[model samples]
Target: MDLLRKSIERVTPLTNEEWKLIVEKSKRIQLKKGEFLQTQHSFVVYECFVLTGSFKTYIMGENGTETVIFFTFGNEWICDLNAFYHKKQASYNIRALEDSELVVVTKPAKDVLFSKIPKLVNFHIHMIEKANIVLQQRVLDLMNKTSKERYVDFIEKNSGRLQKVNNKNLSSYLGISQEFLSKIKREGEVYNEKAR
Candidate 1:
């Protein structure tokens, strides 16, 4: 709850009444590794704030291949905004990468909060804008960068996640084969050692 308060405060200060309303409306949830927060084609009723551990959002293809869309870690938000806002089914699955804790607020609860605190709506709009920018940058990177360059950029940007996420998932997110990812990592290590 403290983390939630801090997260909100980072964007906008909350009055005691507003904070209390949020606390009363949100619920805490814990998930084990491999557990799903939302499944493909399901309605996403809650918007979640990650408290601990990591989660990945991905889509499974008809050929049984999984494409990683994005990853969210502790102190981040995870939600199918399209589904949550529009009452549509989720197009991707959100699964725990490790045992995780989250604070969740349902649509009704969020609507109530929004009505009471207009600044909260602005905060959400900012978050959505940031998400869009990140997605656009990722798309541009995939379109313009070579695999090795993309891998290097990914490593530089997500240094914290290198050890936490597996190679297979990272490869999928990078739109590269695992073998290529391995080769890139090996080459990177060699380059680093020589530089040192």
Candidate 2:
């Protein structure tokens, strides 16, 4: 709950009264590894905050492959906002990579909270805008960057997350094969050794 407050406070400060309203409207859930928070083609009514643990959001491809979209860690937010607000089904799946603790607010509760605390609407907009910008950048990177370039950028942005994900998912995220990812790691090590 503290993390949720901190995440929101980063965008807009919450009054204690408003915080109480938020807490009252939210519910906590614990998910075990391999459990899903939301499955594809399902309605996503809850927008969740990660109190602890790791999760991944992915879509299953036409050819029956899972394309890892993004990973979430502690103190982060995860939700299919478009699907939730537009009253449509989720296009992707959200699953716990490990045991997770999450605080979730239902759409109706969020609406109530937003009406009560107008600043919360701005905070939501800010988060969506921030995600949109990053999403645009990711699309461009996927279209234009080399696998190694993507890997490098991914490492730069998600250093702590690397160890948490398996090679298959990591490679998929970088749009590379596992063998190629291994080759890149070997090359990186050699390059580092030579630089030393």
Candidate 3:
């Protein structure tokens, strides 16, 4: 729990009592590659912090196409905010990209946490603010950026996590087709290699 303690300490220090309360409903779970953390119909009963490995959050279309929304690696939070905050079923899926470990907190426990640790509320606000900024940027990118530009942005942000994601999901996240992503990626890699 030291990692979680450190993550929480970024906003405020936690007392032994406070830490115990926060982790009361938390449990460590493992997900194998391709395992579903939350499916579209699953109840958003918990939110998790990634301890190891990665996951992709996405939605499936009517024709069975998957549109990836985002990826979360170690030290990141993964939750369906819409469903989690509203206490409803998930609208998308969170699937493990590789074997991953997570610390999950049940909604009931989190709902009660705010009252006991007000500092945690501030921490939550910071987390939401950061997540909101990323989401906003994604929307703007989809509206104003070209596919290659988006791919570049993705590389800048994702860095070490790219090799863990397959071409299909990466292209879906970039709002481009697999072939187009491959072309740009090849070109971008060559350009980077030449610069080096």
Candidate 4:
């Protein structure tokens, strides 16, 4: 619960009463690896805070290929923003990449929170703003960055994720082939040797 408090504190500091109210509204959830947090077309009734573990939020193309859009790890919030905000079905699916624990707040509970705790509204805004910034950066990278450059950035941003996730999944997220990712990694080694 301290962690939850810290997560919220990143955006806004809550009063003791407000903190208690928020905590009372959240429920803990546990999921095994490969479990679906929210499937495509499902309504996102809750906002999830990752307590321990990682998740991938992705969309399947018409051809049945998964295109990952975001990764959520411990201390991060994960939800289909469109579904949660608009009260519509989700277009993306959120799946656990490992056995995970999450704290979830239902939409109505969150609404009550905002009404009762004004600072919480600021917290919500900050959350959405952070997600939007990340999404915009991803779009800019896809449009302007080279595959190798993007791969390098990905590795730097998610330093340990490559060790946890399969290469195929990483390749899909980078919009490159597994073989090409391998090649980029090898190229990095060669560049490192030259610099040394």
**What stretches of model 2 exceed 4 Å from their correct place?**
none
For residue 158, model 2's alpha carbon misses the true position, in angstroms, by 1.5
If candidate 2 were superposed on the true structure by all CA atoms, what would the RMSD be?
1.2
Which regions of candidate 1 fall more than 4 Å away from where they truly are?
A: none
TM-score of each model, paired residue for residue: 0.96, 0.95, 0.94, 0.94
The lDDT of each candidate is: 0.90, 0.89, 0.88, 0.87
Q: Give lDDT tens digits, candidate 4, residues 100-186.
A: 999998888888888888778788888888989989999999999999888899889889666667777788888999999889989
TM-score of 4: 0.94
Most accurate candidate by lDDT:
1
Per-residue lDDT over 63-98 for candidate 1, one digit per residue giving the tens place of the 0 to 100 score: 999999898999989888889989999988999999
Clashing pairs in 2: none
Q: What tens digits encode model 2's per-residue C-alpha lDDT throughout 40-66?
A: 999865699999889989999889999
The stretch of ten residues in a row with the least summed lDDT in candidate 4 is 160-169
List the candidate numbers ranked by TM-score, top first: 1, 2, 4, 3
Pairs of colliding residues, candidate 1: none
What clash count does candidate 1 reach? 0
How much is 161 displaced in model 1, in angstroms? 2.3
- Tally clashes: model 2: 0
